[model samples]
Target: MRTTTHAAQAGGEPLDVLIVGAGLSGIGAAATLRRRCPDKRFGILEARSAIGGTWDLFRYPGIRSDSDMYTLGYAFRPWTDPQAIADGPAIRAYVADTAREYGIEPHIRFGHKVTKASWSSAEALWTVTAALAGGGERVLRTRFLYLCSGYYSYDEAYRPRFEGEAAFRGRIVHPQFWPGDLDYGGKRVVVVGSGATAVTLVPAMTERAAHVTMLQRSPSYVVSRPAQDRFARRMQRWLPQGLAYAVARWRLIAESIFLYRLARGRPALVKRHLVAQAQRQAGPGVDAAVHFSPSYKPWDQRVCLVPDGDLFQVLRTGRAEIVTDHIARFTERGILLASGRELEADLVVLATGLSLKVLGGAAIEVDGSPLDPAQAMSYKGMMLGDVPNCAMTFGYTNASWTLKADLTAGYVCRLLSWMDRRGLAIAVPRRDRAVASRPFLGFTSGYVQRASRLLPKQGARKPWQVYQNYVMDLLTIRFGRIDDGVMHFGAKGCLP
Candidate 1:
């Protein structure tokens, strides 16, 4: 990858597009641009030295994708691997390999942490400022700016301050910052949170830890599936790699849509199925009602996936346990629950959750006016209101993230091509004053709720509304009209 900050400074000419964050979405955007908008020059700016964003950063034991790889993998590049639920390092390798295969590495500017981006109405260009590695800075101008920085903040994880935390003698760790040299072997570990991270950790750490307890205020829905996709394996044997992968991808996508639709339309039926599955996994004697049940309906928040019923096996083997209770405080030995029960732990893993951030908390300005994402309404869930020549990719909440990301990239390519052909200098979505606004995300998850007010608003109508459905997005993004009434496209000093 290119270590320099910006291409303009190195060559004295601005790029056609500047992509932020060389993670899954950014890399995919580059590949899409290379294919669809080959005439336009683009550069990717990543803060870290590595290519993988989430996969590379999260180094905790048993870190893996919650979504199956078939759906998570890029549409252009099929994942030929057998594993549906792949680990962090494996996924990281897959992403890095994709970058190399597409020849996207050389256009990526590593160690360029974006601080701010400003757009000029007169020039119809964006001036992006980023910090360099050695302590200097670089400024680059571009006609279009695409942000794929991911939704979560990289600086810190969501760690709630526990009462008497300072008094606790045991080592406290957050999964976001897992220590490499620290050993948890033979130690009693108490992991806080009932989310995906907590479930994954409790089972994996059981092999090395003396005992692992998943301590949470309430239970989350957990379902088990095989790690490998047997159907995908069989398809590969009969069909070509690309064709087999497409079939598996679509099959998984259809199943996801079906399940989510069921959860939304008939909550009681899906809830019963989920609870019954948990009951079978927990076995006869254990009280699944007390330990496995969730208060809210399914799909209100994310459901944790356990591969091959591994978490269930660990629970049955008595290597791990789940404690559903409120944390009273952190005691000298361990955590004290509200039930007056004390659970001792030598090491405490706080897998609480992620801290969400919009645009990585970077400053954005348009025509010397400060811009707030919250004040803007989303157009097609990517471009914000009055945000000229900019688009940000945020993936689906219900399905695989890449499903929406791939669609977003393809649409952006179309937008760029249309602009180039028409000789248009700028494009921005104009939110009608008559339209009503709603929360960007419909979910009631803690992280989302906390950041709701800070996030961009979504309208109730098409082009401005947010739908997590991949099929709808596929048709809309891939074939939607470029001159939609709401989107203003024009040359500088011309009618918009």
Candidate 2:
């Protein structure tokens, strides 16, 4: 492994590219940068002692990838496990392996938390301020700064303020930051939220807890399928490993796209089928109205994915129950429902959704002037309009995160190559007056909608508005010309 001191080597000061966060996105960024700019010096600053970001941080029981590993895994690297749905440890191991294989481990500086980054027009660089793990603060200057820290606030978990929350005597925990010493054996546990986290928690907790109750404000559309694809296995036996992976990836992508479109075009039909499936698993005499009815239209919010019906199996056995109601208040012993009933609980798990932040809460300043991300438009879903030589990546909410991440990475590589060949110092996206635009992230989920005002706007044309279709993204980001419209290239040493 290559190692270097904190200070630059005796060679001419390296053109530094500082990346914050050592999670999947951060590591992916490092790999992409190394492949694109072999001579540029880059460093990854991670807040935690380890890598793996979300996968490493979340260790609650039954924690795993919500999406199938076939697509969730890195694009360049194919997942070789028989089971497409994998547990947290397995995912973490894959991430660690990727870092080691790419020699990115040595580039990562553990326990370095970036507090703020300010841009300087005079130097055309970013001054980053970070707090070290042991003590004291350190400052570093970088030619370019990449914020791959993700959207969630690592320090705080989103726990809605419920009435009489302080009065609850039972142990309360947020799934985002599960305590290592927590013990739920032989206790009645109630997990709140209808998202992926809650669905994953109930079944796993029920094994040790006497009973597990999943409490939610409303229902979430849930689906289940086999953890392993029999066809994928059959093809693997006959075809090469890479060929099998390619077939499986394309097959899954097509199936998902078709199903998603069907759900969006015909909500009633999809809702009936989904509810019926849930009923089949839940069995007769259960209140499907309360347990399966969702207020919003299908695809309005992301549907939860469960592997091999594990959650439904738990419900079918009566070890776990779903209660959909308005939470009135928290009693000393448990949660009080608005229906004038108390659900007794020994342990409460808050699986509530995450609070969204832009650019992982990093402040964006250009030429000593604060830049408002909301006022800007997203160019190619990677770079913000008017932001020069800067790009940020956000993955798909419905599909595998790496699908979008990979596309963005490829596009950034192409952009960098163009700039280098032309001797350009800055590449900024310029808005075309002839075209109409919309908000970049148009999802209707409460968490995303609440923060839409802070997100960048999207263009009506291609590359500006994110193409959720993977095939289209492949053509535009991977194979299309980098000198397309809306991209403005400035000569070296040019300020604007």
Candidate 3:
């Protein structure tokens, strides 16, 4: 790996593209750009010292993928590892490998946190200001800026306020920032939240901790599957590696569709099965309805994926327990439940999800006017209305993030190639006056819902509205024409 000393200023003049965040999206974008435009200069700016964003930051026990590795893995690369549901360290290694494989590691500028990006119409360039890790700032000018920084707020950890929280004497930890020195061994632990993080953490912590109690306000649908993909392994043995990857991808996609359909069409059957599974693990006489039943339909809110029923297995072993209750306050020794019950805990883990922020909290402006993302419409779920030569890649809440990200990257490459062929420097998404739409990301999760007002609107027709289906997105983005009505192409000196 090539490491550069932190310079007071950028080494060269304006670059062709400036990518923010060295995570999966940033590295993926760099690989895509290199393939499409070898003559252009581009660099990646990362805030942290490492490449893996979420995977590296999260170190809590059982920090593994909620989605299968087959779907979660990159489309261009085949994951040869046996474990389909990979852990944090393994996933981080894969990310590092990808960066090294594509020669992206040398181009990445670590400890460079982007603070602001301002667009200059006259220069047709973006002036990006970033704060270095050690304490100083540097500015870079680029022809185009791509934000792959994701939507989560890394610095801001979510911890709900309970009355008398200050009175609690025990140690408190947030899974977002797990401390290495803190010991949970032989101590009673209470994990808050019913999300993927909490579910994963509870089982892992129970092994070391004396006892673990998962506390949740509302129940979430949980499904368990094997850690290894049997079909993926079979295909690898029977066919070529490339063909096996393709088959595995299609098989996973088909399975997702069937499962989603089964949940939606035969709600009772799916619900009964889920309840039975929970009961079988929790044992007879336990009321599975209160802890496992959710108010919303399955897939409405993401169903937590447990590998090989590890969570159920933990419950069966009686090392951990689940409690559905509203927290009234924090006592000196434990949490006071709304039912006037006290749950003692030596340590508390707040896995209460994440706070959503758009474009990694970067300000957006258009023609000297501050752009309101809430008012803008999402053009193909990638670009905002009237935003020129820019695209923001966000993944799916239902499926694997790479599924949408890979498609978006391919589409961006196509757009760049088209612009180069026509000698065009700007391509903006034109706002459709007749299109009546809502926020770009429509979801009820507290974090996503809070930012709904700030997100762009989706279109009613194809290409504009994000079709979560991978096959459809592949065709629309890869095979479709560049001169689609939603996107407006312009020459170097032309406006609009």
Candidate 4:
């Protein structure tokens, strides 16, 4: 929205807050700041030209939100769409519309990719350096820096090389960078991986391709739900739109919490239910044990969602199939599996996973010393330990991402307000030396495990712990005290 970078307009005056990334989290953070702390001047620096971060970037066929829109949608803005499982373009438009509605567009500086943020205790400011799209550098200073750049790299997708990838004659595509003009119609397609992307692609491509085969080393949990919420629709007819939306949101949130708890508390029962559902939906020919059941328990990795049983429907129709085998290599015709079986394909889609990155790959420095997110313990799942005047929104691993992001934004606003009332310049989390550290994410997914060393560590105690539960975070972040003993606050040049 804003054509020029903030540095050009600041005129040597630092902003009250500088938010990185104009994605879902960043936009939500800006809107929250405008509503709660209107007196503070803030600017959003977006690396890309578009407003929708993930939605705008991903253009693969059948690209849709894995999570239901009721919970994924922002709390302030109620999702009025009839389809609870909305597509990428619709979600992108929703984000852009929110920005316009809140008058948050004008404060956004597009194509200003933040490279580094350095905090100075003496000045109590964060000097941010960004690379402009037009090939120039700009510097901007701010009192507080908020990062919502997301957890993964935008420039790269997790593309693993096959043993003989170069020998393959057909075109290989990564879903992250889907080619617009390429046609898969009447072609045999083999999609690699069993994650959300692969699940989405297999069903979507089956409609156009001659046949689609989902090739994976192991199976992931897949669940099916209706696209529209009948209850939500009925609620909208009776109650006010906002109230109806809130009710639906809460209902979905409660169901999620209950299901997650059930899965964790009674893994055997939950797994049996999931496998039974899959077996029934997948029809007779499909082997549920060989291709549907996952080795690990539910929630160990993200469960893939197939709206309206679209994936199973495709499988039953005989347009698509799932192959549970390891890729021995890429042959001249297709992929050769470890079972000495060869699957022929005209096109290969590698929907492996995402490559995770911390702080949008921006280097962070505190008082001229480099700050490694891996080394720093996560405080309240947002702020890093001993890191002053900064907060990053890392969403819930179990539920919808926006649930935690919204809470994080609200907490940041509360923190700023508290500091203002007390005339404080800096607020940093002080990790207790006694608290033990654990992996930031408990997910056993390939992406999470690969980026374990790149992510921040979570603490064992309260306030320092990253509880993936929404209810717990809601109480702690929204209603909790700001001057908790774990967080130390002070003025500039008088460090706490």
- TM-score per candidate, chains pooled: 0.97, 0.94, 0.95, 0.98
Best by lDDT: 4
The digit string of per-residue lDDT tens for model 1 on 1-496 reads: 2345333352357789999999988998899888888888999999888899998999999999998999998999999777899999999998999999989998988888899998887878888888887666778889899999999998888989989899999999999999998799999999999989999899999989999998988888899999999998999999999999999999999999999999989988888888888889878745678877788889999888999988888888788888889999999999999999999999999999899999877899998899989989999999898888899999999988999999999988888888888889889888797889999998888889988878999998888889889888877778889888888987874435
Task: Please give, for residues 103-191, the per-residue lDDT of candidate 2 as tens digits.
Answer: 89988888777776776655666777677777755667777677788877777877788998899889999998899999999999999
On a 0 to 100 scale, what is the lDDT of residue 366 in model 4?
90
Tell me the TM-score of model 4. Answer: 0.98
lDDT of 3 by residue, 1-496 (tens): 1233344554457888888888878888888887777777888899999998888888999999999878888888788889999999998898889899888888888988888777666666677777778777777878788889988888987667779888999988899989989899999999999989988998899889999999999988888888998989999999999899889988998888788779878888888888888777667545689888888777767889899888887777788988999999999999999999899999988888887777777776656677777777777777888878788888887788888887778887788878888887778878877877865655567677766776677887755687666777777877888898768877655646
In model 1, which regions exceed 4 Å deviation? 1-11, 493-495
TM-score order of candidates, top first: 4, 1, 3, 2
Tens digit of lDDT per residue, candidate 4, span 1-496? 2345334432377899999999899999999998899999999999999999999999999999999999999999999999999999999999999999889999988888889888999999998888888876678899999999999999998998879999999999999999999899999999999999998888889889999999989999899999999999999999999999999999999999999999999999999999999989999989988898999999999888999999999988899999999999999999999999999999999999999999899999999999988999998898999999899998887899999999999999999999999899999988788899988889999999999989999888887789989999989989988888889998997668
Which clashing pairs does model 1 show?
A: none
lDDT, candidate 1, equals 0.88
Q: In candidate 3, what residue range of length 10 has the lowest lDDT sum? A: 1-10
Worst 10 residues of 2 by lDDT: 1-10
Clashes of each: 0, 1, 1, 0
Ranking by lDDT: 4, 1, 3, 2
Deviation (Å) of 260 in candidate 2? 1.4
In model 2, state the lDDT of residue 167.
92
